[model samples]
Target: MQKSFLIVVIVAIVGGLAIHQFVPALSASIAFFAGAIIAALLFKLLPSALSQGDGEYSGPMMTLYVGNLPYRVHEGEVKELFSQYGEVCSVRLVRDRKTGRRKGFGFVEMPEASAQQAMAQLNDFVFQERTIKVREAKTQDSDSTEKNPV
Candidate 1:
Protein backbone atom coordinates (compact mmCIF):
# COMPACT_ATOMS: atom_id res chain seq x y z
CA MET A 1 0.00 0.00 0.00
CA GLN A 2 2.74 2.41 0.89
CA LYS A 3 4.65 1.44 -2.21
CA SER A 4 1.61 2.00 -4.44
CA PHE A 5 0.89 5.38 -2.90
CA LEU A 6 4.50 6.41 -3.32
CA ILE A 7 4.47 5.27 -6.95
CA VAL A 8 1.31 7.18 -7.70
CA VAL A 9 2.70 10.34 -6.12
CA ILE A 10 5.91 10.00 -8.10
CA VAL A 11 4.06 9.46 -11.36
CA ALA A 12 1.85 12.46 -10.77
CA ILE A 13 4.86 14.69 -10.10
CA VAL A 14 6.84 13.38 -13.07
CA GLY A 15 3.91 13.62 -15.42
CA GLY A 16 3.13 17.12 -14.26
CA LEU A 17 6.73 18.21 -14.69
CA ALA A 18 7.14 16.63 -18.12
CA ILE A 19 4.00 18.27 -19.41
CA HIS A 20 4.99 21.64 -17.99
CA GLN A 21 8.49 21.42 -19.52
CA PHE A 22 7.50 20.31 -23.01
CA VAL A 23 4.15 22.01 -23.49
CA PRO A 24 4.27 25.25 -21.58
CA ALA A 25 1.17 26.50 -23.37
CA LEU A 26 -0.90 23.42 -22.45
CA SER A 27 0.72 22.82 -19.10
CA ALA A 28 -2.44 23.55 -17.10
CA SER A 29 -4.58 21.09 -19.01
CA ILE A 30 -1.85 18.45 -18.92
CA ALA A 31 -1.33 18.84 -15.18
CA PHE A 32 -5.08 18.68 -14.49
CA PHE A 33 -5.50 15.46 -16.45
CA ALA A 34 -2.46 13.87 -14.85
CA GLY A 35 -3.65 14.79 -11.35
CA ALA A 36 -7.09 13.38 -12.04
CA ILE A 37 -5.67 10.08 -13.21
CA ILE A 38 -3.49 9.78 -10.13
CA ALA A 39 -6.36 10.59 -7.79
CA ALA A 40 -8.64 7.98 -9.34
CA LEU A 41 -5.97 5.32 -9.21
CA LEU A 42 -5.19 6.03 -5.58
CA PHE A 43 -8.83 5.97 -4.53
CA LYS A 44 -9.50 2.71 -6.36
CA LEU A 45 -6.28 0.98 -5.44
CA LEU A 46 -5.13 2.01 -1.99
CA PRO A 47 -7.93 0.44 0.06
CA SER A 48 -7.61 -2.92 -1.69
CA ALA A 49 -3.91 -3.11 -1.06
CA LEU A 50 -4.37 -2.22 2.58
CA SER A 51 -6.89 -5.05 2.89
CA GLN A 52 -4.24 -7.55 1.72
CA GLY A 53 -5.49 -7.50 -1.88
CA ASP A 54 -9.02 -8.50 -1.03
CA GLY A 55 -10.02 -5.66 -3.41
CA GLU A 56 -11.59 -2.38 -2.38
CA TYR A 57 -15.28 -1.79 -1.98
CA SER A 58 -16.89 0.91 -4.08
CA GLY A 59 -20.02 3.03 -4.59
CA PRO A 60 -22.32 5.42 -2.74
CA MET A 61 -23.77 5.33 0.74
CA MET A 62 -25.09 1.83 1.39
CA THR A 63 -27.86 0.98 3.80
CA LEU A 64 -27.87 -2.40 5.52
CA TYR A 65 -31.05 -3.83 6.94
CA VAL A 66 -30.50 -5.47 10.31
CA GLY A 67 -33.19 -7.72 11.62
CA ASN A 68 -33.46 -9.88 14.74
CA LEU A 69 -32.38 -6.96 16.86
CA PRO A 70 -33.68 -7.51 20.37
CA TYR A 71 -36.97 -5.65 20.70
CA ARG A 72 -35.40 -3.45 23.33
CA VAL A 73 -32.35 -2.67 21.21
CA HIS A 74 -31.70 0.99 20.55
CA GLU A 75 -29.62 2.98 18.08
CA GLY A 76 -26.54 3.15 20.29
CA GLU A 77 -26.53 -0.60 20.79
CA VAL A 78 -26.85 -1.17 17.08
CA LYS A 79 -23.90 1.09 16.41
CA GLU A 80 -21.91 -0.62 19.11
CA LEU A 81 -22.55 -4.06 17.67
CA PHE A 82 -21.41 -3.15 14.18
CA SER A 83 -18.49 -1.02 15.35
CA GLN A 84 -16.63 -4.23 16.06
CA TYR A 85 -16.40 -4.92 12.34
CA GLY A 86 -15.79 -1.34 11.21
CA GLU A 87 -16.74 2.22 11.85
CA VAL A 88 -20.44 2.71 12.12
CA CYS A 89 -21.21 6.02 10.49
CA SER A 90 -24.85 6.02 11.43
CA VAL A 91 -27.60 3.90 12.91
CA ARG A 92 -31.12 4.98 12.27
CA LEU A 93 -33.91 3.00 13.81
CA VAL A 94 -37.08 3.24 11.76
CA ARG A 95 -39.75 4.51 14.08
CA ASP A 96 -43.14 6.10 14.15
CA ARG A 97 -42.86 9.85 14.53
CA LYS A 98 -45.98 10.06 16.60
CA THR A 99 -45.02 7.53 19.28
CA GLY A 100 -41.25 7.38 18.69
CA ARG A 101 -41.17 3.60 18.93
CA ARG A 102 -39.05 1.31 16.85
CA LYS A 103 -40.43 -0.44 13.77
CA GLY A 104 -38.30 -3.52 14.60
CA PHE A 105 -35.60 -2.73 12.04
CA GLY A 106 -32.98 -0.15 11.20
CA PHE A 107 -30.46 1.07 8.67
CA VAL A 108 -26.73 1.11 9.21
CA GLU A 109 -24.16 2.95 7.16
CA MET A 110 -20.51 2.10 7.18
CA PRO A 111 -17.69 2.23 4.70
CA GLU A 112 -18.33 -0.32 1.97
CA ALA A 113 -15.34 -2.44 2.89
CA SER A 114 -16.39 -2.57 6.51
CA ALA A 115 -19.98 -3.26 5.53
CA GLN A 116 -18.90 -6.23 3.41
CA GLN A 117 -16.84 -7.61 6.25
CA ALA A 118 -19.69 -7.15 8.68
CA MET A 119 -22.13 -8.86 6.36
CA ALA A 120 -19.84 -11.86 5.90
CA GLN A 121 -19.30 -12.20 9.62
CA LEU A 122 -22.80 -11.50 10.82
CA ASN A 123 -25.32 -12.60 8.24
CA ASP A 124 -27.52 -15.56 9.20
CA PHE A 125 -25.84 -15.87 12.58
CA VAL A 126 -28.20 -17.05 15.30
CA PHE A 127 -29.28 -14.44 17.78
CA GLN A 128 -31.75 -15.02 20.58
CA GLU A 129 -33.44 -17.84 18.66
CA ARG A 130 -33.81 -15.77 15.51
CA THR A 131 -31.42 -15.80 12.60
CA ILE A 132 -30.31 -12.26 11.85
CA LYS A 133 -30.66 -11.01 8.33
CA VAL A 134 -28.06 -8.58 7.06
CA ARG A 135 -28.49 -7.44 3.49
CA GLU A 136 -28.20 -4.42 1.27
CA ALA A 137 -31.21 -2.31 2.01
CA LYS A 138 -33.69 -2.24 -0.86
CA THR A 139 -35.16 1.02 -1.99
CA GLN A 140 -38.84 1.58 -1.46
CA ASP A 141 -39.35 2.45 -5.10
CA SER A 142 -38.07 -0.99 -6.01
CA ASP A 143 -40.74 -2.64 -3.87
CA SER A 144 -43.45 -4.21 -6.03
CA THR A 145 -45.96 -3.77 -3.25
CA GLU A 146 -45.47 -0.05 -3.34
CA LYS A 147 -45.78 0.15 -7.11
CA ASN A 148 -49.03 -1.79 -7.15
CA PRO A 149 -50.97 -0.65 -4.17
CA VAL A 150 -53.79 -2.95 -3.13
Candidate 2:
Protein backbone atom coordinates (compact mmCIF):
# COMPACT_ATOMS: atom_id res chain seq x y z
CA MET A 1 0.00 0.00 0.00
CA GLN A 2 2.82 2.39 0.94
CA LYS A 3 4.77 1.56 -2.22
CA SER A 4 1.70 2.01 -4.40
CA PHE A 5 0.92 5.41 -2.85
CA LEU A 6 4.51 6.58 -3.37
CA ILE A 7 4.49 5.39 -6.99
CA VAL A 8 1.21 7.21 -7.69
CA VAL A 9 2.53 10.47 -6.27
CA ILE A 10 5.74 10.18 -8.30
CA VAL A 11 3.78 9.47 -11.51
CA ALA A 12 1.47 12.48 -10.90
CA ILE A 13 4.41 14.82 -10.30
CA VAL A 14 6.24 13.58 -13.41
CA GLY A 15 3.13 13.79 -15.55
CA GLY A 16 2.38 17.36 -14.35
CA LEU A 17 5.92 18.46 -15.10
CA ALA A 18 5.83 16.80 -18.52
CA ILE A 19 2.57 18.49 -19.39
CA HIS A 20 3.87 21.87 -18.21
CA GLN A 21 7.07 21.58 -20.21
CA PHE A 22 5.94 19.95 -23.43
CA VAL A 23 2.33 21.20 -23.86
CA PRO A 24 2.04 24.53 -22.03
CA ALA A 25 -1.41 25.14 -23.51
CA LEU A 26 -2.64 21.86 -22.07
CA SER A 27 -1.38 22.96 -18.64
CA ALA A 28 -3.22 26.26 -19.01
CA SER A 29 -6.38 24.41 -20.08
CA ILE A 30 -6.11 22.18 -17.03
CA ALA A 31 -5.66 25.20 -14.78
CA PHE A 32 -8.68 26.91 -16.38
CA PHE A 33 -10.84 23.81 -15.87
CA ALA A 34 -9.70 23.46 -12.27
CA GLY A 35 -10.48 27.11 -11.58
CA ALA A 36 -13.91 26.79 -13.20
CA ILE A 37 -14.70 23.72 -11.11
CA ILE A 38 -13.63 25.47 -7.90
CA ALA A 39 -15.70 28.52 -8.77
CA ALA A 40 -18.76 26.35 -9.50
CA LEU A 41 -18.33 24.52 -6.19
CA LEU A 42 -18.00 27.79 -4.27
CA PHE A 43 -21.09 29.21 -5.96
CA LYS A 44 -23.08 26.12 -5.00
CA LEU A 45 -21.83 25.95 -1.41
CA LEU A 46 -21.12 29.49 -0.19
CA PRO A 47 -24.68 30.90 0.09
CA SER A 48 -25.91 28.01 2.22
CA ALA A 49 -22.78 28.15 4.37
CA LEU A 50 -23.22 31.88 4.95
CA SER A 51 -27.00 31.67 5.60
CA GLN A 52 -26.54 29.32 8.57
CA GLY A 53 -25.48 32.20 10.84
CA ASP A 54 -28.27 34.81 11.00
CA GLY A 55 -30.16 35.33 7.72
CA GLU A 56 -29.46 34.99 4.04
CA TYR A 57 -27.22 37.85 3.02
CA SER A 58 -27.42 39.06 -0.52
CA GLY A 59 -25.82 42.18 -1.95
CA PRO A 60 -28.20 44.74 -3.43
CA MET A 61 -27.84 45.96 -6.98
CA MET A 62 -26.59 49.56 -7.12
CA THR A 63 -29.06 52.33 -7.74
CA LEU A 64 -27.98 55.97 -7.72
CA TYR A 65 -30.02 59.09 -6.97
CA VAL A 66 -29.04 61.99 -9.16
CA GLY A 67 -30.20 65.43 -8.09
CA ASN A 68 -29.79 69.01 -9.29
CA LEU A 69 -30.18 67.93 -12.87
CA PRO A 70 -30.93 70.70 -15.32
CA TYR A 71 -34.60 70.66 -16.25
CA ARG A 72 -33.64 70.10 -19.88
CA VAL A 73 -31.72 66.93 -19.00
CA HIS A 74 -33.99 64.03 -19.86
CA GLU A 75 -33.75 60.30 -19.36
CA GLY A 76 -31.82 59.80 -22.59
CA GLU A 77 -29.25 62.40 -21.59
CA VAL A 78 -28.82 60.84 -18.18
CA LYS A 79 -28.48 57.39 -19.70
CA GLU A 80 -25.89 58.68 -22.19
CA LEU A 81 -23.88 60.39 -19.48
CA PHE A 82 -23.81 57.30 -17.22
CA SER A 83 -23.19 54.83 -20.02
CA GLN A 84 -19.66 56.25 -20.20
CA TYR A 85 -19.03 54.72 -16.79
CA GLY A 86 -20.85 51.39 -17.28
CA GLU A 87 -23.88 49.60 -18.57
CA VAL A 88 -26.85 51.62 -17.39
CA CYS A 89 -29.93 49.50 -16.76
CA SER A 90 -32.42 52.37 -16.65
CA VAL A 91 -32.79 56.10 -16.08
CA ARG A 92 -35.93 57.55 -14.56
CA LEU A 93 -36.30 61.31 -14.45
CA VAL A 94 -38.84 62.40 -11.89
CA ARG A 95 -41.68 64.47 -13.31
CA ASP A 96 -44.62 66.29 -11.81
CA ARG A 97 -47.77 64.23 -12.19
CA LYS A 98 -49.96 67.28 -12.61
CA THR A 99 -47.86 69.44 -14.95
CA GLY A 100 -45.73 66.70 -16.57
CA ARG A 101 -42.58 68.72 -16.03
CA ARG A 102 -39.20 67.47 -14.87
CA LYS A 103 -38.44 67.80 -11.16
CA GLY A 104 -34.65 68.10 -11.59
CA PHE A 105 -33.98 64.74 -9.94
CA GLY A 106 -33.78 61.19 -11.20
CA PHE A 107 -32.59 57.65 -10.45
CA VAL A 108 -30.06 55.64 -12.35
CA GLU A 109 -29.73 51.87 -12.10
CA MET A 110 -26.55 50.00 -12.89
CA PRO A 111 -24.66 46.86 -11.97
CA GLU A 112 -23.20 47.04 -8.45
CA ALA A 113 -19.52 47.13 -9.44
CA SER A 114 -19.86 49.81 -12.10
CA ALA A 115 -22.28 51.85 -10.01
CA GLN A 116 -19.68 52.35 -7.28
CA GLN A 117 -17.15 53.59 -9.78
CA ALA A 118 -19.72 55.81 -11.47
CA MET A 119 -20.89 57.32 -8.18
CA ALA A 120 -17.33 58.13 -7.20
CA GLN A 121 -16.58 59.76 -10.52
CA LEU A 122 -19.89 61.46 -11.19
CA ASN A 123 -20.89 62.87 -7.83
CA ASP A 124 -20.79 66.70 -7.91
CA PHE A 125 -20.00 66.48 -11.60
CA VAL A 126 -20.90 69.48 -13.73
CA PHE A 127 -23.47 68.50 -16.32
CA GLN A 128 -25.72 70.84 -18.29
CA GLU A 129 -24.35 73.71 -16.21
CA ARG A 130 -25.52 72.18 -12.94
CA THR A 131 -23.46 70.35 -10.33
CA ILE A 132 -25.27 67.03 -10.00
CA LYS A 133 -25.47 65.21 -6.68
CA VAL A 134 -25.00 61.49 -7.15
CA ARG A 135 -25.16 58.91 -4.40
CA GLU A 136 -26.82 55.66 -3.40
CA ALA A 137 -30.60 56.05 -3.51
CA LYS A 138 -32.52 55.93 -0.26
CA THR A 139 -35.59 53.71 -0.08
CA GLN A 140 -38.96 55.26 0.83
CA ASP A 141 -38.83 53.71 4.30
CA SER A 142 -35.51 55.38 4.99
CA ASP A 143 -36.67 58.83 3.93
CA SER A 144 -36.47 61.48 6.66
CA THR A 145 -40.17 62.39 6.56
CA GLU A 146 -41.10 58.99 7.96
CA LYS A 147 -38.73 59.39 10.90
CA ASN A 148 -39.57 63.04 11.64
CA PRO A 149 -43.21 63.89 12.19
CA VAL A 150 -44.44 67.43 11.87
Candidate 3:
Protein backbone atom coordinates (compact mmCIF):
# COMPACT_ATOMS: atom_id res chain seq x y z
CA MET A 1 0.00 0.00 0.00
CA GLN A 2 2.76 2.45 0.89
CA LYS A 3 4.62 1.43 -2.24
CA SER A 4 1.56 2.21 -4.33
CA PHE A 5 1.12 5.58 -2.65
CA LEU A 6 4.78 6.40 -3.22
CA ILE A 7 4.44 5.48 -6.87
CA VAL A 8 1.46 7.78 -7.24
CA VAL A 9 3.27 10.64 -5.53
CA ILE A 10 6.27 10.17 -7.76
CA VAL A 11 4.06 10.09 -10.84
CA ALA A 12 2.32 13.29 -9.76
CA ILE A 13 5.66 15.01 -9.17
CA VAL A 14 6.98 13.88 -12.55
CA GLY A 15 3.82 14.98 -14.27
CA GLY A 16 4.02 18.34 -12.50
CA LEU A 17 7.57 18.79 -13.74
CA ALA A 18 6.51 17.98 -17.31
CA ILE A 19 3.74 20.55 -16.99
CA HIS A 20 6.24 23.08 -15.64
CA GLN A 21 8.34 22.76 -18.84
CA PHE A 22 5.28 23.66 -20.95
CA VAL A 23 3.69 26.35 -18.73
CA PRO A 24 6.06 27.79 -16.15
CA ALA A 25 3.62 30.13 -14.38
CA LEU A 26 0.77 27.63 -14.08
CA SER A 27 3.07 24.84 -12.97
CA ALA A 28 4.85 27.07 -10.45
CA SER A 29 1.54 27.64 -8.64
CA ILE A 30 0.68 23.97 -8.93
CA ALA A 31 4.07 22.98 -7.61
CA PHE A 32 3.77 25.35 -4.65
CA PHE A 33 0.38 23.93 -3.65
CA ALA A 34 1.52 20.39 -4.20
CA GLY A 35 4.59 20.95 -2.03
CA ALA A 36 2.42 22.41 0.71
CA ILE A 37 0.07 19.45 0.61
CA ILE A 38 2.90 16.96 0.67
CA ALA A 39 4.62 18.79 3.50
CA ALA A 40 1.39 18.91 5.52
CA LEU A 41 0.83 15.21 5.06
CA LEU A 42 4.40 14.36 5.92
CA PHE A 43 4.77 16.63 8.95
CA LYS A 44 1.24 16.80 10.38
CA LEU A 45 -0.87 13.89 9.18
CA LEU A 46 1.62 11.07 8.92
CA PRO A 47 2.77 10.85 12.54
CA SER A 48 -0.71 10.90 14.05
CA ALA A 49 -2.12 8.62 11.35
CA LEU A 50 0.54 6.02 12.03
CA SER A 51 0.73 6.36 15.83
CA GLN A 52 -1.42 3.38 16.77
CA GLY A 53 1.17 1.29 18.55
CA ASP A 54 1.95 1.17 22.26
CA GLY A 55 1.85 4.60 23.91
CA GLU A 56 1.99 6.79 20.82
CA TYR A 57 -0.53 9.65 20.56
CA SER A 58 -0.85 13.13 19.11
CA GLY A 59 -1.96 16.37 20.80
CA PRO A 60 -2.43 16.95 24.50
CA MET A 61 -3.49 13.74 26.20
CA MET A 62 -3.74 12.32 29.67
CA THR A 63 -3.33 8.88 31.10
CA LEU A 64 -5.94 7.79 33.60
CA TYR A 65 -5.45 5.03 36.07
CA VAL A 66 -8.54 2.85 35.82
CA GLY A 67 -8.74 0.68 38.87
CA ASN A 68 -11.05 -2.13 39.90
CA LEU A 69 -11.83 -3.14 36.36
CA PRO A 70 -13.61 -6.44 36.11
CA TYR A 71 -11.08 -9.12 35.33
CA ARG A 72 -13.33 -10.51 32.63
CA VAL A 73 -14.08 -7.20 30.96
CA HIS A 74 -12.52 -6.86 27.56
CA GLU A 75 -10.30 -3.98 26.42
CA GLY A 76 -12.84 -3.15 23.71
CA GLU A 77 -15.57 -2.71 26.30
CA VAL A 78 -13.45 -0.27 28.26
CA LYS A 79 -12.61 1.60 25.09
CA GLU A 80 -16.31 1.80 24.21
CA LEU A 81 -17.19 3.13 27.62
CA PHE A 82 -14.59 5.90 27.41
CA SER A 83 -15.39 6.65 23.76
CA GLN A 84 -18.84 7.69 24.92
CA TYR A 85 -17.20 10.60 26.74
CA GLY A 86 -14.46 11.27 24.16
CA GLU A 87 -11.94 9.71 21.89
CA VAL A 88 -10.02 6.95 23.64
CA CYS A 89 -6.43 6.93 22.49
CA SER A 90 -5.58 3.59 24.02
CA VAL A 91 -6.62 1.09 26.70
CA ARG A 92 -4.06 -1.13 28.29
CA LEU A 93 -5.05 -3.66 30.90
CA VAL A 94 -2.17 -4.65 33.09
CA ARG A 95 -1.57 -8.35 33.29
CA ASP A 96 0.62 -10.68 35.28
CA ARG A 97 3.55 -11.84 33.24
CA LYS A 98 3.86 -15.31 34.69
CA THR A 99 0.25 -16.49 34.53
CA GLY A 100 -1.04 -13.86 32.09
CA ARG A 101 -3.92 -12.84 34.34
CA ARG A 102 -5.44 -9.41 34.29
CA LYS A 103 -4.51 -7.36 37.35
CA GLY A 104 -7.97 -5.76 37.66
CA PHE A 105 -6.60 -2.39 36.68
CA GLY A 106 -5.61 -0.59 33.50
CA PHE A 107 -4.51 2.66 31.96
CA VAL A 108 -6.62 4.68 29.57
CA GLU A 109 -5.23 7.43 27.38
CA MET A 110 -7.42 10.19 25.98
CA PRO A 111 -7.45 13.87 25.25
CA GLU A 112 -6.96 16.05 28.34
CA ALA A 113 -10.48 17.42 28.38
CA SER A 114 -12.01 14.07 27.66
CA ALA A 115 -9.97 12.45 30.39
CA GLN A 116 -11.14 14.97 32.93
CA GLN A 117 -14.73 14.35 31.91
CA ALA A 118 -14.31 10.62 32.05
CA MET A 119 -12.64 10.82 35.45
CA ALA A 120 -15.57 12.82 36.72
CA GLN A 121 -18.24 10.51 35.35
CA LEU A 122 -16.66 7.07 35.42
CA ASN A 123 -15.07 7.08 38.81
CA ASP A 124 -17.07 4.90 41.16
CA PHE A 125 -19.31 3.90 38.29
CA VAL A 126 -20.47 0.33 38.55
CA PHE A 127 -19.76 -1.95 35.64
CA GLN A 128 -19.81 -5.74 35.55
CA GLU A 129 -20.60 -5.85 39.23
CA ARG A 130 -17.55 -3.80 40.11
CA THR A 131 -17.24 -0.21 41.14
CA ILE A 132 -14.31 1.22 39.24
CA LYS A 133 -12.06 4.14 40.05
CA VAL A 134 -10.62 6.54 37.53
CA ARG A 135 -8.03 9.22 38.17
CA GLU A 136 -4.97 10.78 36.62
CA ALA A 137 -2.17 8.27 36.54
CA LYS A 138 0.62 9.11 38.95
CA THR A 139 3.86 9.29 37.05
CA GLN A 140 6.36 6.84 38.39
CA ASP A 141 9.92 7.84 39.15
CA SER A 142 11.27 4.58 37.80
CA ASP A 143 11.27 3.22 34.27
CA SER A 144 11.16 -0.29 32.82
CA THR A 145 14.83 -0.30 31.96
CA GLU A 146 15.82 -0.58 35.61
CA LYS A 147 13.44 -3.40 36.45
CA ASN A 148 16.20 -6.02 36.34
CA PRO A 149 19.13 -3.85 37.29
CA VAL A 150 22.18 -5.77 38.41
User: Which one is best on TM-score?
Assistant: 3
* Alpha-carbon TM-score of each model against the true structure: 0.52, 0.57, 0.60
Ranking by TM-score: 3, 2, 1
Question: What's model 3's lDDT at 61?
Answer: 91
> In model 1, which regions exceed 4 Å deviation?
1-60, 127-130, 144-150
Error of 2 at 20 (Å): 57
The residue-by-residue lDDT of candidate 3 on 35-63, one tens digit each, is 55664466455654434343444579999
The number of clashing residue pairs in each candidate reads: 0, 0, 0
Ranking by lDDT: 3, 2, 1
Can you list the residue pairs that collide in candidate 3?
A: none
* lDDT, model 1: 0.76
lDDT of 2 by residue, 1-150 (tens): 344334444545555565557767776557445545554455456645433544322455788999999998879999999989887888999999999999999999988888999999999999989999999999986687779866
How far residue 70's Cα lies from its native spot in candidate 3, in Å, is 0.7
Higher-scoring candidate on lDDT, 1 or 2: 2
